[model samples]
Target chain A: MSRPVSLPRWADLALLPVINVLVAFFVAGLVVLAIGEHPLEATRILLTGALGHGEGIGFTLYYTTNFIFSGLAVAVAFHAGLFNIGGEGQAMLGGIGAGVAALALGSLPGIVALPIAVLSAALFGAAWAAVPGWLQARRGSHVVITTIMFNFIASALLVYLLVDVFRPPTSMEPSSRIFGPGGKLPFIHELIPGLPKTPLNLSFVLALLAAALVYILIYRSRLGYAIRTVGANPTAARYGGISPERITIIAMAISGALAGLMATNEILGVQHRLINDFTGGYGFVGIAVALMGRGHPVGIILSALLFGVLYQGGTELAFDKPKITRDMIVVIQGLVILFAGALEFMFKPALARLIGGRG
Target chain B: MELIDTAIGVFASGLRLAIPLLCACLAGLYSERSGIVDIGLEGKMLAAAFGATVAALSTGSALAGLGVGIVVSVMLGLIHGFASISQRGNQIVSGMAINMLAVGLTALLGNAWFREGGRTPSLEGAARFQPIALPGAEALAGVPVIGPFYKSVVSGHPLPVYLALAAVPMTWFLLYRTRWGLRLRAVGENPAAVDTAGVSVSALRYSAVVMAGVLCGLGGTYLAVAQAAAFLPNMTAGKGFIALAALIFAKWRPVHALGACLLFGLLDAVAIRLQGVSLPGVGQVPVQAIQALPYVITVVLLAGFVGRAIPPKAVGIPYVKER
Candidate 1:
């Protein structure tokens, strides 16, 4: 007779974030009550707004598409043990670079322009992340601090360019005028006459394709092993003759490029132009998703969807429920991060015991 | 009289802005030198700024406000130290958590209490910090070269301006002079060696970080009650982070941090003066680019890839006491 075993350590690891999110939701319900809203009704409203209607689904799909890119960017860096907080800045700069390519070099055919703009965004993001990577790899400077500093610098630089250098001739707002029609991503409105609704365009398909590529690259490639080995233990990798410096820099650059790609999708497919706060805190949220997903590709997709629903649905719930503002959703997000981060404390030992008992 | 007075006013404003930066840099120096990463200086400032505003607004006294700010920041410092230095948590993560929590909680409390997003209502001039006009400046006002600059620069700055200037020297003395300073340097350089001695490593680290918070709090309160006379939402902006850069670029030295801050403050003053003044060829440089100058400079200085700066060895590593 064998003792019944609990989840293997690997499965238990995945459960930690799930448990944390549930606890966070419970705590957040109390907050809803304090805000004078019915917690049950608010939860229902949030779910319905994000996933129930066709329009809600459209919004969720659009958000999930972009979020997947951001999540993968952070996850890639994490796999190399480099905390890349500069994704926000890199994505912003990437978006602008892509926008410039679209606006200035839009005379080219659709297929060429699209590929060029996306590639340019990826390159811009890579270059941005490379600076900090070089600093960390060669100089022994801390990646976390340097990346944070770079993010601020990137944001300020982008703001400087957007306002003064990139202002189009016609628009008075901070944003540039619409990129030439050739540059815009073909919307579902034009692609299919009777789609579920709205401007949730082909970017969604592109995003899913990118995620699939990422999964294969991370799980099956020799390069992925090097990045993971470096992340797990750099000294061990060095002993094994893998240059940690090269892997670290390559990982960061790829991460930045991925984030940049996400930003481009939003600017090209949805908004049609760059504006102040255009990235909409997507970079920061990506960190949360990456952490929540434990840096797994499938987990990242799931977390991105969860975040998209929370974001799109939370806003709708806030608007319908007068006392709740979009800001309330931020509190919930913050709570999720807090609880998610506390995952090490929340699980592990108990799960270990459970596995031990089962064994 | 008019020209001299205007020059003095501009200099005074420059001093006022420069003081907070210097103070925050000093806070950075203390924490970094003691081998603890202190990115929560922004949160400390925000708490101090809010505390100072609330105290000043309630008591109608800027002094009390400054006091409240300092105390609250010290408490926040202890919390940061508890998490990062003692408990072996990730320093960047803890710092970020503190910052986010401060942002959320400050806004949450402010709205709930005052019906605004982290904004304390503006105060009366009398209730706020006012610059002290130095008496000796009048005697030297007529002298050439030194007189205009001196009168313009040093004569009309508020009390915190003087405190910030004094802090550089005070920091130098504290870092170099006492037994405590030696212990601090030891801990920063090699915590194991410091731990071998009689003192508690965690306690020393907590003290250094807490002291930093106090200084940063003073800086924050100076911003609200003294510089602008009100607490504005997210008013700390990136100043605290910039101060951290200045701390590093200055090689974590007190005197150097002061010099770096003054240079930045001077650039800011000159830019403001050049507001309407067009260059002979290039028309007025846009305000947005001018605003980005400090951040742009920060990146350039940090990329000093010439030879990378090394932080304290024990910095950001939590020390655990073993039996």
Candidate 2:
């Protein structure tokens, strides 16, 4: 057998991701062509829709906020070698928690009510994740399978609460009443005079703050060291006096809390009320974001922004070409996951041979 | 008499519902037994369901639909094999990719082609699989107790139902009795040992994955052509995951998988029946609670509140030979 060729850090981190993304888009283009649409025209529409005007940019950034929270959630868990697919459920629970707090404290001032709702969202998400983490830690269950199961359970719980508990008698829809003014986060347009009115809001700032905090927690903290050590090699971590089980639970908790913060953008900022399936598959999208970003905070933000562009652009494309619905973005997302994640090393050997030459 | 009628109805519905779960569980069983963790079973089934529906609509033949469904599913299985076996990639991530791709492609193509909001038209006549009735079903219906049971629970079903029932024993025999099955199971348990024995680990894994694809295809065809008669967007819902839970609950054994699938199917049937109806002790049971029972049970079992589920030894790890 031949020895494996190694590439420099720049090629490994920067070059490979760009190549993979280009390949994904190339395949997505083929899909567009297969459906009797012009891929180039579609791409033009997407780019212009996402970046052409202030409103488009605002929508893109607004979507980017939710992705950032979910992406950071996946990255935190990834650092601990846990694949936390339950972000969907955790985010749903976060919405429920935020809804509960806002509805209960609706009469209070925004200074008091809003912060309580945000904290409630995190606490609820953490608690939902802690159960699966505890199960995996104590009983030796695989976190992946357990988290997947929890996603279903969480959705069921969400539906039950919406139908039986939250829905007002006067309303027929399975959703809560519109939240009070105190509960709603101020829109970004309100703060900045000239910006077009979009769902973009203060949660975008919160998402950035969360990203910075995650960077510090993962790279600068002692707990982060233990988490990384356990992830890399559990037997070695155990030998070095770190409890892998404890780290697993803690990492999952933090991951779930980050996922929960997405509600600050979706529920508190945009919808201002609890609704079903509002997470809109963004939690699953986070997996792609984290994988494409290579589990780094900086990479996650960039990838999240990319997905935001796809989402905002896809919506615009749908208006121009009914044949190309938002599902096109999902296809692109899948291709990205395939090339950038599962087949990540497919280009490595060739690239190494090209760069380093014969050994 | 009325009580007996209700019992027969529930049992019949339960059996019908169990076919898809049983087929998918068996599909997972084959792949996992050969060291490939196939979380993409859901994706494969969903794609196959769409493929089957489209082919049936075009050809007006249910068998043609089944053929196309199997081909589509096997293609996806090959992709998974390429990623996990050849490229030595993360099996879970590969499976995830397959799932998302299937979800997106099915909806996108279905919408573009049919223009019914991502749904295919309802299948009818020759396009749908008609239930087969046993020779003595009518005669048996006249007798007491066993008559209705035999007629409702044992007699009439589409071809896929019987195929699913037979797959269990076939899988068991293949896994435990046949030479190829032994090699496949050995590769899953310890691929290096199989390689040392001069048998090809990748070949065995690829075959197992192909077999999984065929079975999932049958399951998906059952959903669109036999069970539902049309392809609905996200129609598989979480049945694939439910089947996965059943696989875990069964401890990866074929006979146990049948039992587990039946148990879950029965729960589903009961949940459907109990909706909007209040019982004496339980009151009006929330549908979601019943729907969540299978997942909760799987989690508890995984936590070892029930028996332990030890998977195949080398499952999820890529095989790489040492120099």
Task: Supply the TM-score of chain A against the true chain A for every candidate structure.
Answer: 0.93, 0.98
lDDT of candidate 1 over A1-359, digit per residue (tens): 12333566656676666777787778778877875678899889999999998888888878887788888998999899888888888888888878888887677777888778878888888899888898788766777767777777677677767777778767677887777776788877679777676658877887788788888878899998999999999999999989999999999999988988876678878777776677777887787788788888788889999888988898798578755655555566556665665233445456667767787
Task: Please name the candidate that would achieve the greatest TM-score relative to the true structure.
Answer: 2
Best by lDDT: 2
Q: What is the TM-score of each candidate against the true structure?
A: 0.89, 0.98
The 0-to-1 C-alpha lDDT of every candidate, in the order given, reads 0.77, 0.93
Residue B176, candidate 1: C-alpha displacement in angstroms:
1.8
Q: List the residue pairs that clash in candidate 1.
A: A5-A358, B35-B315
Query: What TM-score does candidate 1 get on C-alpha atoms?
Result: 0.89
CA displacement after TM-score superposition, residue B44 of candidate 1 (Å): 2.6
For model 1, how does the per-residue alpha-carbon lDDT over B1-323 read when each residue is reduced to its tens digit?
Answer: 77666666666566666777898899978887788888778878887888888899999998899899999888877767766775566666556655655565566555555766557789776668887878877788779746776766867667777877888899899989988888888888888888888787877788789779879988988898888888876788877777877777687888888887877676667678777678778988765566566665655555665434567778877666555
Best by DockQ: 2
Candidate 1 deviant stretches above 4 angstroms: A1-12, A22-45, A107-109, A189-199, A320-324, A346-359, B1-10, B116-118, B125-127, B137-152, B281-308, B320-323
Predict model 2's lDDT versus the native.
0.93
